[model samples]
Each structure stands twice: as C-alpha cells, then as structure tokens.
Target: MLRTQIIKLTRAPIRSFSAAAVRTAEGDTGGVRSGGVASSDSFNKREAASENKFIREREMETLRQLKEKLRAQRKHLDELDAHISDLESTKGGEQN
Candidate 1:
C-alpha cells in the first residue's frame, strides 16, 4: 500500500517533467520561452502544486490510521479497566 503510494508520488514529477519537455519540444510555451525550454517558473509552480496535494493526501491518510489505532487502544484500555474493577469487587466480597 505504502509502496504503491510512494511509487505514484515519485511518478508525478517524472510525468510532469516529460509533459513539459514535450510541450517545450513542440513550442507550446503558452507564453515566453528561453533557451528552447519552457519557463522553469511555470513548471515549478505546477510541480509544487502537485507535491502539495500529494503531501496533504498522504498526511490525511496517516491521520486516519492514527485515529483508528487510538480508537482500538482506547477500547482495549476500557476493557482492562473493567476487568480490574471486577477483580477488586470480587476481592472485597471474598473478605466480607
């Protein structure tokens, strides 16, 4: 799962790079171009946007997993507390 996400995450940059390269080759700058290559500014902007989206998605996934773990732990802690209370009550009864 994580490996797949990482693969996808890493692929975005390459995909964007190749797309930009093709666009540059075709002279589709949509604006000014220098040295026969698309402006780095636009490319960088797109890359940064994609990266930010990926990071936000990844962080949300991590937070979801953490929340699930915390819920399970809380449930287990509640069960343990009940068991301890039962044991204490039984001990008190036996002494009476």
Candidate 2:
C-alpha cells in the first residue's frame, strides 16, 4: 500500500518506458519492441534542457551576488580613503 502510494506520487502522468515494459510482460506487445524510440530521445532532450536551465539560473544568481559584494567592497574602500585623508589633513594643520 505504501509502495503504491509512492509510485503514484513519484511517477510522471505520462505513460513511459516502464509502462511499455509492463505491457510487454502482459503480452500486450507479444514480447516485441514498439516504435517509440523517438519518445525516449525527446524525453532525454527535455530532461537535459531542464537541467541546463536550472544550472543557468543558479549561475546568474551567483553572479548577481558577487556583483553586489564587489560594489559594497568598493564603497568601503572609498570611505576608508576619505577617512585617512581627513586624518592626514588634521595632523598637517596641527603641525603648522
């Protein structure tokens, strides 16, 4: 019962190669291979495209984060430079 539920939840709605195997086992195809070779090819292409899209989105997010970090660091460096210059000018005035 639990196994059946898992199968129902995990399986795609479309009939797949496993269904074809089951049909063959039940003599639906009389132990002969059907002409759905193109279906598997299309399925593989779709899966690959999905994985590629996922990777691309992750890479774009990582790039956006890095850009934000770089912008922050640049701002901090500029602030530090301004503070150092202010300190130097004050010390020069005191010595004069």
Candidate 3:
C-alpha cells in the first residue's frame, strides 16, 4: 500500500505577560497559560466550602430532631409526675 497523508498545524494566539497577569489577577484565566490556569487554592476552597455546608446542614437537622425528642420526653415525664401525685393524694385520703 502506497499512501500519502497531509497534516495541518495551527498556532495558538500569543498574549503578553502583563496582559496574562492582569487576567490572572482579575480571576479570569480561562483555565491555562494560553488562556489562563485556574487557581488550585480557589477551587479547593470552593469544594471545601460546599462540603462544609452540606455537613452543617445535616448536623443542624440532627440537632433539631434531638431537641424535638427531648421536648417530647420532658412532656411525658411531666404527665407521669402529675399522675403519680394524683395517686398519692387518693392513697393518703384512704389511709386517713
């Protein structure tokens, strides 16, 4: 088999260092050098913040549920106390 192939190469546009720096400072680096590299710290911070928010929301929900459970238990204890007091009063009258 005898075949010839033609390939074309394209050059990326060039930008001055000062211009690139300005873009980087403004946080608009388009994700690499030819465009702009995204800052790793900023990306990581964003991810951490999102994870923290999820954790906080879950914890808050759990706390709310626990508080509700505590309130119900307190109410039940108060009712039990009232019933015991009534029973004690009746027994005292019967004894007298």
Give candidate 2 regions above 4 Å deviation. 1-35
Indicate whether candidate 2 or candidate 3 has the larger lDDT: 2
lDDT at residue 6 of model 3 (Cα atoms): 25
lDDT of 2: 0.83
How do the residues 1-96 of candidate 1 rate in per-residue lDDT, one tens digit apiece? 999999888874534435354335563546555654456777768988999999999999999999999999999999999999999999999999
Instruction: Evaluate residue 40 in candidate 1 and report its C-alpha lDDT on the 0 to 100 scale.
Output: 72
lDDT of 3 by residue, 2-94 (tens): 232222224456777674443356645355434233666667689889999999999999999999999999999999999999999999999
Lowest summed lDDT across 10 adjacent residues in model 2 is found at 23-32
State candidate 3's TM-score: 0.60
When superposed on Cα atoms, how far off is each prediction in RMSD?
16.4, 11.9, 12.6
- Clashing residue pairs found in predicted model 2: none
What lDDT does candidate 1 reach at residue 76?
A: 100
Q: Candidate 2: lDDT of 6?
A: 100
For model 1, the stretches where C-alpha displacement exceeds 4 angstroms are 1-38
lDDT of 1 at 42: 74
